[model samples]
Target: MSVEAELIAPAELGTSVVSDKGESIAPQAKEAASGLLDQGDAMTSLAQQAPSVVERMQDFLLVGGPVVWILLGFSIIALSIVLVKLWQFALLRPESNRDVTQALALWRAGEHGQATVVLKRNRPVSELVYIAMRGVLNVRQDMDLLKDELERVAALRLNQLRALLRPLEVIATLSPLLGLLGTVLGMITAFQRMEAAGNQVDPSVLSGGIWQALLTTAVGLAVAIPVVVIHSWLERKVERVAAVMSDSVTQVFTGQQISVVAEPELEELKRAA
Candidate 1:
């Protein structure tokens, strides 16, 4: 009867074979329509269930206790930071060592401008290398000053790379201690309850508090271990970038120093000619 059903009915009935005994095609058409209706209902039901599932998760977090909830928050933050670092390295870190080597060769061959142009076009160059290449081209006599500037830039960018890592370090160190504190407090509460119910000492009271203590401790360890590993991995990556920056920039400026020293000698020989 509906517009959708009318349209679908013709397409479905064309595929279906009617009995030679003159069976009605109406039931088969209705069956096809019912299948479409069932699909729509299934989608509707899934949409309705989504919010209920979110509600259940919220309820679970609420019951996870403060220490557990704080650890949960740390876990999410750590995961996000790790993903960002991984993405950063994948984009910035080069797969081949030839980028720096080729650029160095260009600069040493009296093509200083061309070397910079090459570096600019290279997609996987480090930020440190890029900054150094831009600043060091005009540098001739002040190799010491250039070194100072490069060191300063390297330090600043290295710190930026290490930015979110400190929080992960803090989380790693604090989680286990928080778990222990929760366990101690839980034990204290359990004993107090036991003392108050001295004559009627229920086994449930003792066992229940102990389990809560264990749960908090377990959550803390779970949070701390992964946080520590992720922090270490990120720190290693930052260090590697720092080394590449330092080595590449040093190679470029070392050649520049040679050029500066030879410029005066070349000019003196020209006067003698």
Candidate 2:
């Protein structure tokens, strides 16, 4: 019998068997069972210790003796802001670089109505383009007034883009200072103890106290660095949106000018015809 046949039939559980090809089915079965048992033991160990792992993290964050539960609070706030911005950015990402370029090409070609229709199809960069081109369609509308309205709308969109960013900026600014304050407090406490001990102070105690004080500074930096990075990234996204608005508005104004200048020539041609 082949090893495969032996595995499927397994003549007897835990019994020795030699395949017709002289392969040892017994050993293979034993090894497979051993692997399964090892995996089971590992999973059981993890299941048993899962609660302790969470408990340990909770205890450390809550009791990591040093300067600033307030620093921890700042970290939490920064994290919340980061997450919210990430979600907002993901939803509002500018998705039509090529489509917008094509639509703008149409606008510049003196096809203002068709350009807006093309932009409408893109769904992302097109909204601003559509809004700008709306004013272009109405020739009697003052271009400057239309431009001013676009700016106001752009400002509101930008405000929305940067909504929670202020909190992140605040967190990045204050975490280090809070950490430094903690370090100072820790050093003061250590020195007060040394003074109280009056020549009997242990060197180890002083060293331990100094390190405890430094821990706050380390954690504060850890929180601040990532927050600064994320804040800068979010700011860049806002700038990208602004750039899109500017580019689309420029296209609208160009199309308007082209259409406006062409009108008198068309009338002259009509009179001649």
Candidate 2 residue-wise lDDT at 8: 67
Q: Which lDDT tens digits does candidate 1 get at residues 1-273?
A: 999999999877865654422467668888999999999999999999999999976764554468778888888888888888778667655434566677788877778777776664433334445566666765463757766876887777677678788988999999999989878877888899999998999999999878777777888899999889888878887777677776787777677678778989999999999
Regions of model 1 farther than 4 Å from truth: 1-64, 94-97, 108-111, 121-141, 256-273
Model 1 score (lDDT): 0.76
Highest lDDT, which number? 2
Off by over 4 Å in 2: 1-59, 62-67, 120-125, 258-273
- Candidate 2 per-residue lDDT, tens place, 1-273, comes to 988887867565434444432465667888999999999999999998998999976765554464457777788788778888777767666644666777778887776667767664324456767777777778687978987888887787788888988888888998888778878888988898899989898998789779778878888898889999999988887888788878777867776677679989999999999
List TM-score per model, in order. 0.65, 0.74
The window of 10 residues in a row where model 2 has the poorest summed lDDT is: 13-22
Global CA lDDT of candidate 2, please? Answer: 0.77
Q: What is the C-alpha lDDT of each candidate?
A: 0.76, 0.77
